[model samples]
Target: MLSGSPTQGMFSNSRIGNSESPNSGASSSFTQPIIDMSENDETELLSITWNQDYHCFAAGTNHGFRIYNCKPCRETFRRDLKVGGFKIVEMLFHCNILALVGAVANSHYPPNKVLIWDDYQSRSICEFTFRSEVRGVKLRHDRIAVVLEHKIYVYSFTDLKLLHQIETLANPRGLCCLSHHSNTFVLVCPGLNKGQVRVEHFGLNVTKLISAHDSQIACFTLTLDGLLLATASITGTLIRIFNTMDGTQLQEVRRGADRAEINSIAFSPNVQWLAASSDKGTVHVFSLRVRVSGEDSLTQPNVAQGPALFHQNSSTSLDPLISTNTGANPNSTFSFMRDMGSWDGKSAHGSETFLLRLLPKYFSSEWSFAQFRLPQSTRLIVAFGSENDVIIVGMNGSFYRCSFDIVHGGDMMQKEYVRFIT
Candidate 1:
């Protein structure tokens, strides 16, 4: 969902001005104008969403929508229907198929309809009409999930057959996510109670309900393999990770002590790290302590075991006295003392533990190791890139690529910047 208020009448069918190419450093211009320019200075940017693979993104505007490649930051193509504005334009990876929902501006493209557009033919192939306005639309290879105010419907993409329906709380932001893994079908949506999440595991024919937080859920995401789930609440100070297989709370990471609106949360491709963007103009990345079942040990050498050790049915606990094996290192006389000092590998050691114990839990919470600062006023979304880099896209038509130091985490170094729209 967008992080800022929607602007009306700010966009026109006018042709956008050209800018320098990101790679060639030469001036580049779009094709001849399809419609005459208006007096407006800026186009209404309704929403910006990355494709499933994060290699490209679609920008929904009043005129229509435009697709752009993310790496070199170049516009691939645009369609100026001139009919109305689009509130949501979700691309199906790099394919020509797109799921589009209209803004409340024109009757030609109503807000209560989801149009399946095949950009190759430049026309909508089929449409789904609803009684209430459509809040969100997610597309998979074999399914199409639609989100409304209080209900979610999953449909078979091949024949548009209804497969499942779920009742949820008041979800105006259309909070829902799907796992894109080829071997798994996992769907997550708001539960009947606030701060709750309902996970639907289709492959296993199991449903797990997890109470994620005390307040309303703001944002959540799932790993590509559909094994781990990350969630953030309205408080926005803490982000929690859960094991989707057994509904176990694996770990919790703090974004900050001050409450702020979390715009997005993303897990690294390797599942060794996580990143979150907040309204406070900072993007935070944290090293994950929990490991996946089949993940490469080289990805996170420090972590000893995966979440399998902390299953709900298991007797293991995070307490050092129960989980630590002091006898494993018998050669050292102070091995027990050393293990007691370090509860988790990332926790405080020696005298620092005494001071941390006196303070509130917020003060001793696990904080982000790396951060990138941006303009607080600009609404942005974040995604992981190659190596330790991150891709930030803003509603103001700005794109930034920054890399973080994995060994010595701190501020991220800017690698590239571009004004995608002017």
Candidate 2:
């Protein structure tokens, strides 16, 4: 790893512009070494993603893709895709498999075309054209899931062979997630019904659906092994977890009674914790308790019962919890949480157990055991870097590294920030 310290300001992708003069001096924001591309300087960054091992990360910019090594904090190499420019791209681990989608801002490339590249050769190996514009692309070892507005096409990575096609409800965000292991294949997407999620098991050729929310599903994620799934709706106040086997609702957590758009959901590698971020500028951490044999894990309130839930019978269904959208409440985040923190099951548990089932166990009203408020921004995405560290990036052109210490209840505080690009 490089010995130099990381400050604010100094990062950008490939460019063709005049270099910064030495007299220009240091930037007010904490960035790195100064840079200057050539004259056509359109190096604005659009998206960023890390490889499976986190050894390297790729930043998609208007000019091309910039690959950076994490530990040493240096540029490994720059892959020029300047012809039309790749506004967004996905990398398959540390391998050379790269996926590209043209941005609306670029006129040179077709928005409906996908260019699959191999960094090893610095060239695109496959060119795929679709009827409608592509919203997102997910790369895997054996298969690739290309997300369109209302449909998803799965293709074999080796041959680009069409394997299956799924139609979804209005999925404008192109929200989808999959397992990390090459051997375990699980694909999740919004279901045909609003607020529902459809799970696809490609290896077994089986599928299941879970009614996860009442409003439209905003985003969702699958655990490393693909057995557990977490979902959030457009309403944004709540999140739910479901079993892929029988589509049983395992847990439900409230972001706040007030409506907020969910930005992302992630599961820790250890499966000991779950994290979430929203448009509200808050990143939350929830501790998970592992389930024991035959115990009804859903009502535990904290431990991650999903590992055990997957082992349990898939045919069993707990009394379903129908959701209602009362819209955003001024005191929704606070008042609802206060009530949840103290309400006991005795007062709510009964024949229907409606109120009890709705209690905060799975969806703890105070879902966030630890939370961090970020600078107000239009977009935010978060992922666990290590058990105690978090990596967050916002549309404001800033990247953050935060630390969560369990010894102190894990209240995350920003440890580092880099103003990558403006």
lDDT of 1 by residue, 1-422 (tens): 21121211221322222212111111112122223235354677889998887888999988777889888889887766555778999988777778888889846777887776655544445567777888999988778888999998887665555778889999998999998866668899999999999999876678889999999999999887666899999999999988777787877788988889999999988676788988888999987766543444224332224343232244554321112332322222233445575555555466454655787777556678788998545778899988698999988888999999877778999898998887
- Tell me the alpha-carbon RMSD of every candidate: 11.7, 12.1
TM-score, per-candidate, Cα-based: 0.79, 0.74
lDDT digits (tens) for residues 262-378 of candidate 2: 888877766655788888888887654322233233333323343443344434344221112221221223435434544455443232235546665533253566778886755
Could you tell me which 10 consecutive residues in candidate 1 have the lowest summed lDDT? 19-28
Q: Name the top TM-score candidate.
A: 1
Each candidate's clash count: 0, 18
Cα deviation at 230, candidate 1, in Å, is 0.7
Please estimate how well model 2 matches the true structure, expressed as its whole-model Cα lDDT: 0.63
Candidate 2 RMSD to the real structure: 12.1
